[model samples]
Target: MEGQATLNRRNFIRLSALTGGGLVLGFNYFLSSCTTEQGSGQAFDLNAFVRIDTNGKVTIMSPNPEIGQGVKTSLPMLVAEELDVDWKNVQVEQAGLDTEKYSRQVAGGSGSVRESWESFRQVGATARQMLINAAAAAWAVSPGECTTENGMVVHKTNGKKMSYGKLVESASTLEVPKDVKVKSEGSFRLIGQRIPNIDNHAIVTGQYKYGIDTKREGMLYATIIRPPAFGMTLESFDDSEAKKSAGVSQVLRIENKIAVLGRSTWEVMQAAKKIKAQWKDDGTLESSADMTQKLHELLAKAPKDKPRRKDGNIAQAFASAAKVVELDFDAPFLAHNTMEPMNFFAHVKADGAELHGPIQLPERARKRIAELLKLPEEKISVMMTRMGGGFGRRLMTDFVEEAALVSREAGNIPVNVIWSREDDMTGGFYRPMYSYKYKAAIDKDNKLIAWHHHSAGVGGSASPDSFPAGAVAHYQVDTHSYETPVSTAPWRGPTHNYIAFSEQSFMDEIAHQTGKDPVALRLELLEQAKNNPAGKVNYEPDRFAAVIRKAAEISGWGKPKAANIFQGFAAHFSFASYVAQVAEVEKQADGKVKLKKMYCVVDCGTVVNPSGAETQVEGSIIDGIGHAMYAELTLTKGKPDQTNFHAYRMIRMSEAPEVEIHFIDSKAAPTGLGEPALPPAGAALANAVFAASGVRLKNQPFIKSGLFA
Candidate 1:
């Protein structure tokens, strides 16, 4: 439970000072930290920020690129928390490219909340503290008595109040205070309160600008025609007709593909349609069927366990079992499918390059652009725009590099290269598909004896990286990997996403056979984990049991419910947060699933923005259910099979279940809300479906199971 906690006020002040003008925002605490900047004593630079004039118009410098994860508002809330200001008065802006003003901005792993929580807090708190100090000096009273509220300091004795804007000049002159006091948990007024998303207005009104909306002076639009498969190379291109298309300016090949540039994105699309480019498939084809077989093989041939934690002999216990049952579960590959597709505006001049895009990691994008241009990182600038959505896809900077290359080829006249929906779907990079085989043993009394679980995943499809792998004992882990034509990277919940389905479903089977309550059955396993567990360093049994029991009670388990709906339950600990989900669903007479309701309970320590955290948890659970119910990617001859929305499906508003989230308000430091709630919802739904029907559905997309039953 203890590691390096989030940065504090002192650290934030130091980092802000180095970055020139510091940025401050309140992000929910959920960003995964496996790849966070993990060094000390290195001061950051702050040239990319601009705090508003003292008119109470605070323009926050946004560091992490947001693609609909609500960072535009959520992140700024953190700053407002320490600044002692109301959330309404704050105005926010996207941070431009500058290492001096930011740290690593990679946005994957759902670490956005926890990763930037303290640093940004310090920025807001430091500035506000200084402002209060300035106000105190002006009032000639101790700051202790002059409380700040909604950007104004009130000298209660004198009944005089002044806005933070009135003290900016004086506050800016103050030296950075070391270790400024942060608000205690009980004192938080805005942090744990419900506030609408900061960008909600812009988004609803269409005023919000994403990377796809970016335009520069004399900017040209580009759509690239890369090889159909990953690792495939471009062999040749005949652009005679493409150059003749209306508004087409140039056709150039860069980074193993031909880019068609034109005066408009539409023109570029038209021109690209005309280009007849020949590609030689350098990568081998990997159909879903082929990959599925390879996945099973890998699961069966797993190697020695990594064993981050251990408890007892899993093999010995299973060998002595009075009953044993085995099952396999599969999770398919997925896409980020951000509303704003991959696009970046880059103006590569003889001296430098200016890049603008919706990206997760600005540092990575900057570095990648620098390398491609053969220029120094300092010479390349990245301007992050508000993302339409992230979902861990925009974290890759390859799109940025592609934009830079196209801009360079266009003679550095600011050019924005955009991917069509088809391009995004077939281009490359996907959530790795995964498979899990679970076997459980029980005694004559129907008490569980032992369990053996393993995975078959390629690339990034493994358990949540934060879950200590060596924590389990009597565990065996082996991976079977074959080269895939598609690229792979992290998705929401990463590996924990799939493992939850398999493990929770298998656990449900145990409860069903023994006539024990499902939630109680899991508590029993947590009890075993408490005594002689499978891993040495797995989760604390008490905490795991706490979430399960809490979820059951909060969900009104064993209580009466509406007609035609059955409840299923599951619990998981991920992203440093514990979550339990109970899904209420109905199988319609026509065979379509109606997800009537979902009840989610989460314990993420101190609740930061209760509203924001709840929203995140709700959305994540929906995404998990959506993926399990319907979402898949396939390939043929190394070409992506699904080209757009028609083939690749997502949970629509019509199909989205009604979600109610309950947060366990713990005094412990807050964890993340982005991904922990996602893992169990799928498994919970699966268990619920089985409860309704006599048949046990073992596959994902229960619809896939419907065919057999």
Candidate 2:
């Protein structure tokens, strides 16, 4: 495959005059086009750019926010790879939300690398070509005779080389080339190599600063006391005792909550604990039992909305089937539980507002703060800090808004609003609770005929077009939703996270009931999809099959292993990437099942930063398994049951299975890796548990299924 296609005219390139002595190349090949500044005739937001200094140092600006996805390292590799620079000579800087200089700056959906793959490469290649043109001009030779290697422009005929830094001045004066060609796969040196994460050294040495560690001059620490439970509203508050506490400066009511401001976090926390607040339910206070009961009722009733997807006849196919099997799966709400919790620093004044903190959507946060503080967007500046963890929690700017509001309320004295672990767990948004009902029809010849999936949840919970849809002849998917006071947000893989488990586990059950090999059954369905697709296919069937086959081969599926060892397999496609996972479990003599190891195969196109990609896959698998095995959040009378680590369990190092990751070799453009590997891990483990115990787990948190001691 070509390294990159020819650039269109609309994807313009420009040479900017930098005050410092260096070559600066601004290029735009953005997936989404942003308007250029009026009368400037140049696209300011070029997606990415490269700056070469006189010291032979390369500074590449990363446009997107980094949330531990290793984009800080992998994205710059895209530029350095095409720039032909040695890894040691390159440095990366996180670009802020400069609409005129950056585009696609958010950190959600794992689109950072995928979106910038081609464009960033072009940015580097364009600069390299400019430098070669300068060298060719000096040598009085054709530009075609010059090639770049390790930051040097080489005259292949005379064996003469010129450092990029030496030609920076002449290169900056030259016109930007439009037809610059990127390197092919065979020429890649920095990419597909095991480059360590750029922040690894700082992270391990405790020198990296997260948003929670943010501090500003004259900053006051604030701890808010919002409604303790959902559906409740603050009736009144008495802050006389809070004001009497030592170090407590002020206690004021903001909206429905009281904000305790002090010199230190501990003081504010203690002072807030002394306040007397009364809350009353403004609506029906709900419990977990009530939500589960409502879910059952909705799934049992016919969906009011039209089916998300439909192919062939569903009622007739099941009615005419030789045999049918139905099963239900349930999942509970989960807290994000980011290590740093929720914190942001904001100083909102009449003229402008300065916001600094960790946020996935820095642009969105800036706009929200501007709207709330009644300031112009240009007047509000938002800077992103390295986050401790996101997991989709930072996508919501509520915490950032709270900090801005508190700062404004505190007389614009630069306040940092922080949430305690309890505040984060009890009040933060969660993954919507879900229940799925799957029914499949098998023909007399034991061939799968039809599939009907019904899911009901607090919000949407089904991916209608995701696999099994285009594979089955008669397929239909319906979803039922109910509104509640509970808050829900996008978690890791979002809908794919839970849907894959239910869908893949149902496939395993069908295979067992029909006396077919699970792995063979999936491959057969994939073949059907390839040969005769039922409807609009959103994924590449060949790519999906490749991962499945690779996973089976690596796990030694259907082959004999150690005593009491059993295996289960699952595959899913999400974020434009395909992944397959095989879970290995050991059935102990005590009748308990232990997950020993996991084998994961991914086809995310060309792997950039092999170490980072492997780490992402491994972390995703561990996160998926941890949530599937132990995580659960429940409510009683609108109050959370578990608010801290002592009550809410996580997968420990002892319980975490050893994960082996493999990526398929492909020349296709790279895709997202942060989420694709997560969707299949739960299902693989669930299937393996059944293979060992002969008991099919139908609910989330397999630990609660009585299969483990």
Q: After superposition, how far is residue 285 of candidate 2 from its true place, in Å?
A: 1.2
Task: Kindly give the stretch of ten consecutive residues in candidate 2 with the minimal lDDT sum.
Answer: 38-47
lDDT of 2 by residue, 652-697 (tens): 9988899999999999999999988998999999999999988998
**TM-scores for every predicted model:** 0.88, 0.95
- Measured by TM-score, the strongest candidate is 2
lDDT value for candidate 2? 0.86
Per-model C-alpha lDDT, please?
0.72, 0.86
Where is model 1 more than 4 Å wrong at Cα?
1-56, 172-176, 302-311, 464-473, 530-534, 538-540, 560-563, 587-593, 707-709
